[model samples]
Target: MLRWVILAVVVVVLAAGSTLLMNLSTSPGTSWNLPVTPAKAGPMPKAVVEGELTHEFGEMGQQQTGKKSWKLTNEGDADLQIWKGTSTCMCTVAKLQKEGDKLTLKPGESTDIDIEWKTNFVTGDFHKGANIETNDPDHPTFPLFVHGKINPPVVVIPGDTIDLGAINSDEPKTVFVAVYSPDRPETKITEINTSKPDYFKTDVESMSASELESGGLKAGNKINLHVQPGFPLGTMREEIVIHTDHPLRPEIKLTVVGSVSGPISVVPDRLRMVTVKSKEGASGEVRLLVRGGKEAHFDVAQKPEKLEVSVEPIDPVGAKGRYLMKVSVPKGTAPGLIDGEILLKSDLPGVAELKVPVSFLVGAN
Candidate 1:
């Protein structure tokens, strides 16, 4: 009876150990060979605008500010990243509710973008634009536009720039501009000034009713600009400032852009010494003339080396000032280029100095 009892206990112990080992090796929660699940990708970002891309502000006035708003919506599954971009001009700017340059929008999110600009003294139609950069593949760059006409209290016909064209320094140039206040016609010219006092002078006259009617002005003045002959040679970019008694339009600047030709001039502006044999050398000449039959005294300075220069007065033909300048490079010169210039200094004001570039290229024999 003792042996049978012992054997039954041993068999029960062996069965319990085998069940525990099976559970440890093959449990669903602790499996060693389970398969890995792949991750699914989310949707891309989408940008949608609710209204038109352009805004019309009608007619705006000077010193006034204009503002427009646009709704930007993100119709996507993933987050939308938008970067702020530059506006059309410095006077115009775009702003958002947030302070940072980068803004994120979740799915089905929307925000407002505001564009503000100030009306300057310029007249006529104006168009401004701003850009919005987005991560959306379909819509990389979104453009917004604002356009309108600007009406100032004071009106200048033919715009703010007065082109004098080509001006001869020996003769005076005159141009006319009509300045008037459409609403307040009785605006008087209080004072006048200019950037170049020696070259610019101004005169104003009241516009006749018929004259005003022709120009579509209610009341204003016809400004006469008498540009004297003392302006320097080359190019002149000057300004004329006018002061009015009207409170709304007190001052306005008129730009004068022109090219002035002095009494002294030159032909074949640049002397081409070109390529020549080192043994043969090269030679050239330039014809110099003073317009209006005016006599000039020029002293040549800063002449290049390995060259000879001579200035001789030509025979007077029809009361014209003319001269012959001769430049010569002697034979047996080195195989190199002579890099220098001849600066002609004049005794007349405004015609101070003239530069002539010398390109003396020499080839080996």
Candidate 2:
């Protein structure tokens, strides 16, 4: 009986030692108390899109669109959920070959997604991408890029829009822009004209070697926009049309925008109030300040019925050239957009009248 007892003790000790050694040999943090049968991986979704992640459409026209189709498959044992995701500007996903907004692909199942991009929005070597969202744990979102050279034939470096910024109605300013052709170096500008000849003058010059290199073209011209003095006050946006000899694009339009100010100016040039509770209504304030050591007295020349306007000196005696103009929407005003102008008459020099565009939206909270 004693020998048997000793033998049983030895066997128990050996079993304990084997378990400790097994736990030590296994990965760190692994437990020895798990179930007898090892746990197997559960069913999970997988998202896979076949082919190269990027495709180049080569050189194409500005107005033309580039399209491509991709095949997405579910190689996993579970169902896959796919939906459209955000895409870059000027790029969109066409109606899927599949019929639903969200698609379900079983094991070994596949679907096709069509993507289209507009080249006219940009020029030169352009790269745009779109995203595909899925329920796959491995790949929650997949990204694909479309590459192509946009042949605007005539390319404008640094955009065609020139913002003159804040210019005194009496001050003259000048801006220059570059226009060239990546396809042909000998492109010529036949004629250039400004919509408002009274305020703008145009001239063309041969682009320097460095300018041409920076424009990524061998030939092009630089345009000088001379903004003359005494233009109308308030916001000024003018168009300068350039007639080019390019057969594809006969003309290019440029825009010059800026605010022209007189001695008197109003802060919050445009007053806007949105989501105003119709029951309570709302109002906005505009600060009128007269520069150049001058004073201005304001009166409401004209206003819409939906609006109530009032003018008050910022400080009746201490402040000399500043006032507060308040435009309000009455409590009972209808629930819609109130788009109107508040014509103001001020005593400031050279500004016969001032128009302030006011927009208010009244809604039920």
Q: Each candidate's lDDT (Cα)?
A: 0.78, 0.80
lDDT of 2 at 352: 56
**Which stretches of candidate 1 lie above 4 Å from their native place?**
1-60, 63-149, 246-249, 267-288, 291-295, 298-365
Clashing pairs in 2: none
* Candidate 1 backbone clash number: 0
The residue-by-residue lDDT of candidate 2 on 1-365, one tens digit each, is 99999999999999999999887879688665666876558998888899988987777766677788899999988999987777775566764333346878999998887788777656668888788889998899888789878877787766878888988766788888888876666889999989878778889999998976775667789888887776655666679899999887789998888887877777888898887988898989998887765677778988888888999888766677788899988897889988877878776666655667788988976
Q: Which one is best on TM-score?
A: 2
- Model 1, 1-365: lDDT tens digits are 99999999999999999999998988878857778897646698999977888898887767667888889999988888887676675434444434347788999998887778877775778898778889998898888888988877888766689998888777888988988876566778899899977778889988888997887666788899998875655456678888988787799988888776777776765587667788997789887787766667777776888887776778766645677778888889888888777767777666765556677888897
lDDT score, candidate 1, position 94: 47
Clashes of each: 0, 0
